[model samples]
Target: MSKKKLWQSISIVVATLILSFSAQSEEIYTQNFDDFDDGEIELGDGSIIAGTAASIQGGRLQLTIDGQGLGFSSFSIPPLEGSSQGFKITFDYEMFDSVGANDPADGFSINYGGAAMGELGSAEEGMNGKGVQDNLSFEVDTWRNGDAEQGVNISGYGDGRDLNQLAFTNGIILDDGQRVEGTMEISWYPGKGASFTTTGLNTNADFVDVETGAFTASDDHTFIISARVGGANQDLFIDNLVIETGAGGDSDEDGLPDFWETANDLDPEDATGDNGAEGDPDNDGITNFDEYENRTNPQNEDTDGDGLADGVENGTGDYDGPEATGTDPLVADSDGDTLLDGVENPTLPWDEDNPEKQPGTDPNQFDTDGDGIGDGSEIASGTDPTTEDEADENSYRQNFDGFADGTTDLQDGTVIAGAAAEVVEGRLQLTKDGQGLGFSSFSVPAIPGSSNGFRITFDYELYDGPGANNPADGFSINYGDAQLGELGQAEEGMAGGQAIENISFEVDTWQNFDAEQGVNISGMAGGADLQQLAFNNGPILNDGEKVEGSIEIQWQPDVGASFTTTGMNTNADFT
Candidate 1:
């Protein structure tokens, strides 16, 4: 059964009975997320696809992906009576794996009834804007970060993953770098937990014993405490959760019902969404409730991404069709076309005016051009939406006449990082001259591989650097699932400098111990060991030669990609 659906079977009576059977505390309230019905836990934000659909699998809450599921899933936290003397939260968290091990690697956070966290349409950055004013977050950050909204900065040097650092921010803090592994705990003692000298900074925070590693809570008022976890790759597991209250068994000052916070895992201190009438996160010109009913993100403006506003798609002003009809707001393109849902729907298609124009194909047809290829595929391939001619240049990925059309166009699909690309006449002239060097990448729209296989063709001319028989740096072609912008640099240039999980074919014209005038393939970027594709004893391309070539890579589902090269250095003519 689906993890969220798993909680639907447990009734309120059973819940109460389970609570009654557990260790009843007039002061402490806790939850384990076990033995509960489906509705007891919530995770519509894709927590299921990240790792396992079963949230309680392996007896712990697992937050695995940095892409798919990066939202908060809350469970009930018993209401804390207004007489808050002390509060402490402890959980187990480990950085399962960093995203590409890139600098500023992602992390996760443990928040108490604060803001609704998680990116609606994307994975959320770690520990950012996830906590509320009255909340305290044990931010186990793996990346160097700072939140201006929360007034906390912990920017440090390094790629930032292997470092296990922890910080305390009650919406503010003095970031004490604490490394944790096993069962890490953050507890707020009662001495200075009543009131603070200030409200925003760590100085206003109740003193923390850096030596003893203890915390004090604010005694300002009896606050209701809630709990949630907003994560991406920061796999956290929860077991013993204990929160102590001031007086009665329920929240008194928050004016909320006794079982509300505990039932929904909300903080009584936050009169926001926990009360069912909270704030809108995405600023999409619609209330959070409307977003919820419409199954859109209150935290994202373009939920379905139909080009029209979610509010407009909801049949607002000038819209008088069926309620929530005309154009689907939650689906970017309802017809499975790569085109936005707002295009060619109940209205006319977008204007196909220019060479770069979006196709005006029928919104209902997968292949708007009737070319046997889906409209989405045609669009991704950068072909004209109205053409069905397979031999047309529009159908081809690139035609050297100065432009490489389709989804993998050199100028559109890639950024010139650490390099200069000059298109003179009909040829792409790449240069690494003088003391400077250049590098750029070309993206080809992914194709049907493993069965029909895939073929990519490109022509290149590499110029020699102003070195004595050695050029500045060589050029390379690396392919994998990495982003399209760069070959490897994190902030500048390309993503190729890093080991971005791709096999690289280096066409070197520089003669060095590691580099030579040859074609070498390596899984490692600039690593030692290499497999030769086409080699020359001396600097070959330094003669200002224009070489045409193609790397044909084939793939199978279970099996990986294998490649072959042809037409290296125009050997058919060998001029």
Candidate 2:
């Protein structure tokens, strides 16, 4: 599921107990606005625009003009009563003239309840007409006023004269003029609950639906659509308004109620025709009849509220798998991992129907493979989420066997040579002779949780060349806070200048004296002389022959560090 769907799913629930019955549907109100004169002052419903800044332009209800002064206008439909069955209100609207699309100063809303028509309640203040007692407003707020984020905002004024924001959308912005054109549907089941859905919004491929929990059924309601503008403004217009009240019966006996069909813009009297029970209006594979029976929205492809289409959920879409996900169609997150099923398993052609097949992460388990890192985190870190990495998520190991002639790219770092350094016999040869100064810096990304300390281990081989007793200088492993891919000339086993705070573990091959020989760990705190942290002299070489050994260095902040050598031809183990 997308971030938007994840947020909205918290409050939405499948309405399974909604009582369905048989009754004739009534279209109480509808206005296309095309019948009115281009610049008519009077609306067809015996109502006039209550605010002077708004008017009917080009046969459309122009709520606010672009770049115009503060605008607030409202008009009401004929009064209607609350029904025990249900009601649906739908309308298409657009905010254009791009000037203030991002933050349009203000926006509009649809208010329903006992509030009087033409009151223009808090419209002047960019509110849903404050003091509109016993009314609920479904508002589309463009401006971010105070603490409330912009988008679909549902607020209500109770009998106590108190106003409260009831619900809203999160991480969704519907302010762009190019894609803000949308259609809204308000479906209310009186005392049961209500759902507010918007389509063609900018951020989501599926409709954004917000469900309002149960509320007391109002006895009578006066519906009003209003808009406003403050210092900034955009052209806002409303068209194709529809409102239906009362219950609907299965007119054609196709398992779909008449009121449901009408509300979804389907033909109620036809069973086998277009928009009928057999028709897949949304093309989600599941027919209208299945949608009605399953309690999913017929006009929405993703009725389960995510990127997964309903057809895919029903095991009949683009997904490829040996077994199909039999997840409950009404459930959003099947595994309770705070991630939707579709989001956790986005890959196709799975060997199993398990939602966790893609990226080797299990949708059934948040931390697949029992790794401390979450599956999402592992996937993001370029690690196998389904497997427990021996080096953990941020750690990686690579042997430069190939790429002898080119750069070797590995997880967490890249092996790049500098001058004398080259890949020889599947190994990085930093220097071939005693005077051959070379350096190869592998850019290792700092692993997370490093404050707890980290360890580095590597294998090395050194031998006395022909006629040479031993290699003169030696190599060192350096770690420092410096630029990426930065290195200093290789000499005395140091790779960076003294100006950088660098720590080095140097192995001296040609010892000059007791103090200048053996193995030494030193550091430079930048702008200071090198300071020895530790030293140890051990049998790390074989006389006139090849010597092989492995070294391990572990460091922790404040607690200092330790160095250990293994498999060395020494009388005693070196630490």
For this target, which candidate reaches the highest TM-score against the unseen true structure? 2
In TM-score terms, candidate 2 sits at 0.37
Worst lDDT run of 10 residues, candidate 1, spans: 155-164
Instruction: Give the TM-score of each candidate.
Output: 0.33, 0.37
The 10 consecutive residues of candidate 2 with the worst lDDT sum are 11-20
lDDT of 1 at 178: 26
Cα deviation of 556, candidate 1, in Å:
26
Q: List model 1 lDDT by residue over 1-575, tens digit each.
A: 77544663343345455445543322444444455333223423112212231255444554443333344433324344332334455444332333443222233333333233222111122223222233434343343234322322121101111111223332422232322234434443222222112232232223342211111123332222112223223333455444544322344344333333333334545555534435455656776445533545555577656665676565332324323434556545544545665554323343545322345555445555565555555555556656674643232353434222111223323343333443334345455344233355444433434144333346544455332454435566555545545445311223334444455555555453433445544453343223443343334344434444555544344554454555444221110
Kindly report which residue stretches of model 2 are placed more than 4 angstroms away from their true locations once superposed: 1-27, 81-85, 100-102, 123-129, 145-148, 161-163, 171-179, 203-215, 250-575
Clash-forming residue pairs, model 2: 121-129, 122-129, 122-130
Q: How far out, in Å, is residue 231 in model 2?
A: 2.1
Candidate with the greatest lDDT versus the true structure: 2
lDDT of 1: 0.39
